[model samples]
Target: MHEFQLPDMTCGHCAGVVGQTLHLADPACKFQVDLPARKVTVQSDEDRAVLAEALADAGYPPA
Candidate 1:
């Protein structure tokens, strides 16, 4: 799994946006958003950098 640490992702809305962004990038991806931990764990065939870039372009750059 690819884990992203989103420092500003702190709410359900952020999680939803993250989900949408990831789904747009990789429809087959499976993920979980942990708000308290500010983390997003993704299982995808896409490269980690691709996923990270997608998230970054969506304004949630991973740490």
Candidate 2:
């Protein structure tokens, strides 16, 4: 699992968007977004950079 800090994620809608975007990037990947903690954990074979790009494209840039 890979963990990313998404400080800008502030609501259920944002988490849903991020989760959907992540799924769109890699359909088999599993993810959990903790909006209160500003963190996301992803389980996948894809590289972190690829995931980061997907998050960025989804409007929730990862740190």
Candidate 3:
């Protein structure tokens, strides 16, 4: 599992977008969004930098 902070994620829609983006990047990836913590945890075999770029491209630049 990998962890990142997505400060811009504020609602279910944002969560959905983030989730979808990750899925699009790596369909087998599993994610958990902790809205209050502004954190996202992803379980994937993909590279972290690639995932980060995918998230950025999806509009939720990680912290």
Best of the candidates, lDDT: 1
Error of 2 at 7 (Å): 1.0
Candidate ordering by lDDT (highest first): 1, 3, 2
* TM-score of every prediction relative to native: 0.97, 0.94, 0.95
RMSD of 2: 0.7
List, residue by residue over 1-63, the lDDT tens digit for candidate 2: 889999889999889999898898889999987788999999999988999999998888987
RMSD of each: 0.5, 0.7, 0.6
Q: Count the clashes in each prediction.
A: 0, 0, 0
Q: After superposition, how far is residue 40 of candidate 3 from its true place, in Å?
A: 0.6
Give the TM-score comparing model 3 with the true structure, all chains together: 0.95
After superposition, which runs of candidate 2 have C-alpha atoms over 4 Å from their true positions? none
lDDT of 2: 0.90
For candidate 1, the TM-score is 0.97
Model 1: colliding residue pairs: none
